[model samples]
Target: MTVNRFLIPAFAAALLGAFGLIAAAQAQTGPLRIEITEGVIEPLPFAVPDFVDEGGAGEYARNVARVIASDLSGTGLFREIPREAHISRVTSFDSSIAFEDWKAINAQAVITGAVTVSGDRIVVKFRLFDVFSGQQLGEGLQFAGTTQSWRRMAHKVADAAYSRITGEGGYFDTRVVFVSESGPKNNRLKRLAVMDYDGANVQYLTDSSSIVLAPRFSPTGDRILYTSYESGFPRITLMDVGSLRTQALAEQPGTMTFAPRFSPDGSRVVFSLERGGNSDLYMLDIGSGGLQQLTNAPSIETAPSFSPDGSQIVFESDRSGTQQLYIMPAGGGEGRRISGGQGRYGTPVWSPRGDMIAFTKQHQGRFHIGVMRTDGSEERLLTASFLDEGPTWAPNGRVIMFTRETSGAGGQAALYSVDISGRNLRQIPTEGAASDPAWSPLLP
Candidate 1:
């Protein structure tokens, strides 16, 4: 079937070239594209009929397409035309396109795929098209994984589709590690939990027997660094994601270590160590068990995050008389202040792109999640509420997830995400109350 699409002027040329979009400029109909900006734009209308099951796949075929639909639609950039209104059904893996049929339903784009199962393995292949232009959007792609990895395979497909149209890296195939909270507000039990970015496939890493806070995924996504209270004090603990093995680091006799983050190369960890009455930043070499102090300030310095290249560290410090953001050499030095706003800022996290820094700010009794350029200019607040803190960037740095808490005795903390443009602010689905979300890099 045919679908009619219109390419947005803001991003059309670049997207057309990146994905090999075959729509001719002189054609009567254009290719579908979304113009991402701070303003509201109608989502691109698309359709995904159930994926064709080659053999013995049964529900896996339909489930894969459903997941892809969910992934794209959840971004608020695409809208799925319900299956009920579909006039064309995908009947075979290599069926011919019916561009006219899709165009009748006003679908700008269409996705079709096939699922094949052999023994314990599954392979999914997909193609996205601009139905109105009668041309495919991106190159053909397929993902192969074990039967148990079907969801990830689906996410990979969605990621490809999203990237081709938006000209931006996709975040669907990543995970988030956060603190899972339960029980009463006054005495909540906390544990380390990991889940898909959309909050599915939840797996707890540490039990609630000991409180876990600020779980950060390693650059490779194979390990985690977090602060644990099992030793009767906040100690930074490292855990192998696959084996669940835990190791305590920076175990000074009289100091407390917390807020640990991994370097871009995953060979070192930067954290905060509190001793006497002062807290400062420190870096630990993972292989040689070497330690180095990065700060010697009397005031607090914590929440250190490394730039993507591992050359600079952006952290929150009180050395400037009030909490603000600072950027220092990864080898340690007197960093310069970056945040000149009239607010107290903390929990500074560097974006994977190394172009922006996301942080939490408090001013006039309102908490906000905001981002600014690495040079500290063009600061923009993305969210504001009673209590918003702990900002984490998605793999592409296009979106940010942070913890938002309500006020009062029965206050609860939940996760929320917003585009860097400060649009599409919505709560992330969690089993219950959760906080301190850390997004892992895109899965390899």
Candidate 2:
């Protein structure tokens, strides 16, 4: 997961629907929009009242509304008007709108919903409205799932409202895989764990008896690729996310594999293979067990990432006398250098949009997370600290999450995310220190 940030201005804070949003009538001012640049003076104000409990929903209605508000608020692009300040309540799911009431409190947008819980299933529906324009932002939609997936239902509602407001794809329905750490900093125990995008509902995938690093999700997110040391040497291991079944991926005797990432089609994996103290990039066709070396340089070449279309690969190499970024055809070929910066760059990750690459840069004794255009122009540093590295992109490619470690003997590492525009820098809450976060594609 890789290359890092540059400050592109006038970033649109899009409101993408959760599952989907059908374009509807527009307001006199058109759809609500905001530029999410640095130095936020004000956030878009929105209101979400407690959902109406159609039947047997009880506390679920309130909890769902809270989660929706939390998700939107966390973005730093929207602010939630407290429920206590609301002038009216949503007593009925299909009730008439109170635009004047919401506007009186300076709310530009409002979200209303209803929840119905049947025996083993739950149905949640929601709508977004532009208060001043008195227009529904999009067609109302509902999501159905088992009762156990209640939180995901809430996230869907939030995603819908967010997408409607922002006009971009929503990321609320996504999950993140990360390395959970415990014990002293000098004697840390690490395990692979998966959790909801908001850091909720965490589940351990592998025990901490053996070390794991750089866990990456498959294109469909049904599997994971990570470097494991269970065999007393680093090897790329593939695991079925659902059943926890595992297998070694293309591990040859006397060769170590690490930093593996799935190709766009999920049929191949691109990773770094080290042999005889030299590291290079290689591609493995998972279905055929065929291996192809992509880079044959004596210099270390690692952190290979496929472009969204899988036509090319962006990676980091020290072949330029210093660590830097390069791009090459998916097949074996010579790589063209894209990074010409003063500092060393590594961990180049192509954007989901296929227009940018995110990475970590070390400059003047300071570590920074940054992003650059695919051709290596418009470089922008999003974050700077004692140690910030290994950036992973959000499902929508609008945000990047990575490891931020504190300095000193008792230093700690935690997961942090920042918008590509460099605003909304936030620390993801975890039970313990966490790192190497890989964001999954939005769940189906």
Candidate 3:
């Protein structure tokens, strides 16, 4: 099966409004030439030599090199040359690189680096070479930071190399903030958990006493917005991720708020408000205590997501007697439905690329994953099954992370990823039954 990439109507309007000439020029320039398909194309081979330094940072340097190599290899797009396969060792940055040795091992790209340490500070210099073409793709770049930041520096280098080859943004240096669940479904213990993109370093930022859901990372990955039931009711909470210090947003008594998402600027959070008996979309100023109601309707209006430019919002509502997607101004205005007359669309999540919105559609007792343009056109279903919803975009927007639940037996729920082309469905490992998975933006 093939997945059809849907372009939100609002994004097309924004392109014509903001970059009319550039958009037109690109249209004339034709579609992107490179299309990744589901075939056994030879993986791009790469070699990452052990970084050496004059200072005795042996273990640290080796770990950094390992992280860089792992990040590149985990994308499923690159194959790493094993350390035992290396024929030559590079010790100095000025040493002549042996490109043939890397090519002989079927490596198309080679990454060489040197590490140095001064007190608590460390410096890392790395170069990326196109071994097949026998040319340097880019000049060597160096990073200087504290010893603890060495891992981050390695990720940065890997990201740069990945971008240079793929011609698209890289997500190696990203973090995923998700609600970690344990215990039974009836009395589950949940906490805010974060992990590296590769699931290597897992850390729980919050305890399991409180029930938290829908943890969204800010654009800078420094803060998170989530709905917590700590105060005996569902309320939006903002926390500085680096500090784990949290403060409740504007809360109303006898009301519940959920499905919160951060604005592109990270200055505000758009969420659904269930006040009295109605659900509507509201924007809360993340910095100030100001509140702006974006949707005023008796019908359910939930899952509001901001456009990348912070100008418009895509959300789901039931104004038409069935759930569907709608787009309105950031400050609230006349809304337009955009779900292509689907059965019932909910959990509409705007893609990071700002071109599409992934949503959950219920049709004939079955669930489907679909995308559509912002203005309610070109709705295309990606995946359909017994239960598949809560679609979250991979940082590059080429893939979607969602939860897949099985029926009967234990009714297991697990996280899975499907490429936008509806191929390469891979299951992401979790400690236990997991659902409502959210992907974070790439780390800066």
Q: Which runs in model 1 stand beyond 4 Å of their true positions? A: 1-29, 37-39
Q: Give the TM-score of candidate 2.
A: 0.93
TM-score of 3: 0.84
Off by over 4 Å in 2: 1-31, 35-41
The most accurate candidate by lDDT is 1
Error of 3 at 136 (Å): 0.8
Model 1, 244-334: lDDT tens digits are 9999998999899999999999999999999997999999999998999999989999999999999999999888789999999999999
Q: List clashing residue pairs in candidate 3.
A: 3-421, 7-373, 8-373, 8-374, 9-373, 9-374, 9-375, 338-376
Candidate 1 lDDT at 193 equals 95
If scored against the real structure, what TM-score would every candidate get? Answer: 0.93, 0.93, 0.84
**Would you list the C-alpha lDDT of every candidate in the order shown?**
0.87, 0.87, 0.76
Q: How far does residue 119 in candidate 2 sit from its true spot (Å)?
A: 1.9
How far off is residue 46 in model 3, in Å?
2.1
